[model samples]
Target: MDSAAAVSFDANGTIGAYQIGVLISCVLLGVTTTQTYIYYSRFPEDPAILKALVAFVWVCEVAHAICVAHALYQFTILDYGHAERLFSRLPISLDTAVFFNALIEQSVLGFFSFRIYTLSMKLYVPILIVFLSSVRFLASMVTFIITLRLPSLQSYNAHWSWLSIAQWSTSVVNDVVTTAALVILLYNRRTGVRRKTIALVDKIIVWTIETGMLTSATAIFMIIFYLTMKERMIWLGAFTVSSRMYSNSLLASLNSREALRSMNATQVSLHSFVSRPGIEILQTTTTNTVVDITAKFPSQPQPFQANRQCEEC
Candidate 1:
């Protein structure tokens, strides 16, 4: 086959892979959302802010899945020429969907970070971080839109690269700040001095750190993949698919309902043990009157001494 034909064939395969990856991601997100709901249900007394944050994240995940699914359908069910023609015909709508999906993903992550901060009670810091991160996201979205509007890939400007870099950089910073907030919370807790509390905190911290690290790592990989696979659409698609799958898996594991349930159970047990009623002594008595006193004498050794002196003389 000619080079152009080979490229097209490879692109088709990539598109298929991307579709499958997106479907898997969608499934994972759905499961995660359900699990989150269960956790929220179990803790009806939890802070409203946290509940609202999780709800927002769930909605964002749903929107992301829908947009990705539509994008996949546009690319796969329709022929490339036809798909391109349609996209070109309604460029704004298609681009808007893509932009919104990306925006939602980042917004969800930021929201998660903010929730972490809220749990830690580091009020002003999270607010500042979210604001800064939102700016970065918006800037990246604008650049992405411009990139999409380009006549062709060859004519794509380099500014998009800068924007992607900014987005990822800001993401890393946000995660770092969130992790620090979690650390501060753990440290401030008197429970951390105890063995069980220490172990629990360790697990929580590990999961939080892992989530942040994985996100940053995946973002880096996507950036690299996008840059190198400019000519190979299949590789690009594979990268996108793998990135989303990895993210979904990490999120599902981190937000597992079972883990949250277990933590709650532990807390309840501790509280019950500490709060249970115990016996208390109410009165004390002292008796000081004494009647009998006896006086004893001393023994003399004068007789034995006289005998010893006579013997010595």
Candidate 2:
């Protein structure tokens, strides 16, 4: 095989990295579908705006998957044995995929920002998050436009590297800020709470950290790979999967409400009877089972009261 062909298929090179990224992203798309389904089925009564956001993210993800698959097909199948085509202008599908990715990121980040607002009842922090997210999205869109005009992806790196840096740096900063804000707010809420409520708050903080870390870590590595190894498309691999992480994180957060509520109820039930054994303990459940962390952990802790059916028992 010629050197070009060999490099094209080199496991440590561009095509190889892109192929692997595509495979992982496709697998995560399946996960996205499942999470979307779970969110819709379980939380039918969620606020209309929240429901719309989930639907919009899912749709964008599906479109992104299709675009990514098309790009892969063009690279590996349609342009087989043509090394020049691999380095040629970007595929339309790939360009569209980037746009979809930006959309997904913006939506998910915005949703999280709103959640922070709900939790803290403060707009400054959430507003900052939204601002960062908007900048990232705008930069991505500008980059996408530039890619269309560039003769090759290599030329893009040559001319407008600063734009790429801006886009990715804002992304990393936004993720870190969002995660930190949620954790700090939740941690503050943890104070002056009983063991049961603290447990719930701790669980939420963990989830926020985990989800934030996954996306933030991916963004960090993406910029690193791009800056260091753009020639081999290593960054493309990370880019392909990054948007999916945001979507999954959002859905996972929404779906976890049920579990959180169940946990709170179990903790309450267990402790309510621990103090009064052999008493007929009848617990009344609230209809709102959805996990609203803001409601669960109020700015001021409310005294716990149990509605007992058998006070005379």
Candidate 3:
């Protein structure tokens, strides 16, 4: 935020902080769009609900970008050089943008809750995650209604700033808890599992942490700047892009499952010395049971006995 620019609120819709936030949000929308295309291309076999969620989030992002763009266009172009229009109270377009954030957050949180349920094999963490997500959504709704009820933006902020705080605070807490739970769940899976399974778990844990940080950090930044920089609109852009982080994080995970499949397909084996006249190697085939046979030449296929006897025995 430039010292001179912060004071100058002419055209470009307060081209100091709010302008940057909207532009950055548009950039993040592009990032998420690329990830969405890759997800559709690479993971055609993904679950239908997962596909639907991606599509919904994409639509929400498109709508969100449009709303922000409309606000910019209205404030800067239509009402250019009007100091009275420097800071909007509750523009219709900006108001529309707010609920979209809640929608994206709730959807992403629900998706992760299901993931936690799958990985943790229980509902405690998932329930808590969903609860936090619900609280955020409800807070946004209350904020929206109060904004409509209040006489002006200043009045609304004075009366209902707590709603905004609650929304972002819950979002931050939800992200931290969800990420920690997933990391712990993945860590626990390493016990009594194959090296390949352990490697996959490690990858998931890394991914979970990275995505979690992206969302949590953005939300925290939004809250901090919103509170600390009361005289400026710098926090507006941070809030604008926060939803994109959640949307992209979920989409990336869905698309990156390809890595897991590839990892599993790369077979690994250990070598042993039989110490015969010539090197003897034993090949084992299993189907719910194991059979060991001693053969002079390892190249010859050892017949399965239990399977053979079970045919008539």
Candidate 4:
């Protein structure tokens, strides 16, 4: 076969799609690893289970990157220009690599599940989130099984696109539910809080929405392209990097807590009273502003530690 004919069975766009996504994912993976290190370095007080979960996330990401790299190696380098092998049989490595997508996503969702539980203290919301997450994971698992069963990539798409649809749609719904829960909870708590406390909570709410959107939007794009660009694998390509977005969002949330807390501390300190003796001390200015953090996070208030911390800040 000539050069053009060699790559014809699968278009160049389809061939390049996974490679491009893997490259993007690898870059974001590096960012996530760095952010995880930063979170550990900054917050040694974080729970042991939380630390273990972070390590698990790292391992899943590394394994995912390796799997995709190997699949690409099989497609492009190891079997270069072998159209029959490339086009006729689906690589099992791709099956494993895409399965990692479900793993990575569920890990992030698990973390958020606990967070939603903590923030909302409602069992039903977390239960629903967990159920949706499980649906996504199971859909991906079924998709992988279908990939393994089918020899042809074309045939697999024809047979199993429904599972991909189910997975991506579940992810989008889960993210939307989680984001709405967080934002609503935060906004509700801000009602009776002080100015500084309200500002801090507002910042939290913004980050909450932003991080939620990152994953939600990525999954939405994946599903849209999956439906529209059937031959190109554009959606699958986006799936590679989208997991990193979730990890980065979680790490950012963890790291930002400390940074924002410290910064808020400084801002609070600036309000301290100046010790200057004056001839006429009839009027004095006191910059120390007291806050009731119980009123800040009304449901799960850390009155002694958090309220006093802000007061001392």
RMSD of each: 21.2, 7.5, 12.5, 8.9
- Order the candidates by TM-score, highest first: 2, 4, 3, 1
Q: For candidate 3, lDDT tens digit of each residue in 234-300?
A: 6667878888999989877765654455443212111111221111111123211110111122333
Candidate 4 Cα lDDT to native: 0.69
Give TM-scores for every candidate, taking all chains together and pairing residue i with residue i: 0.64, 0.84, 0.78, 0.82
lDDT of 2 by residue, 33-113 (tens): 998898778767555667778889999999999998899999888988776777789898898988999999999898778
Candidate 4 similarity to native, TM-score:
0.82
Ranking by lDDT: 2, 4, 3, 1
For each candidate, how many residue pairs have backbone atoms clashing (under 3 Å)? Answer: 0, 0, 1, 1
lDDT of 1 by residue, 87-189 (tens): 2322333345445545555655565554444344346876866776677668757855775667643344243556655665666676567657756654444
Residue-level lDDT of model 4, residues 41-68, one tens digit each, is 8667555666777888888888888887
lDDT of each: 0.47, 0.75, 0.68, 0.69
Superposed Cα RMSD, model 1 = 21.2
Give the Å shift of residue 112 in candidate 3: 0.3
Candidate closest to the true structure, highest lDDT: 2
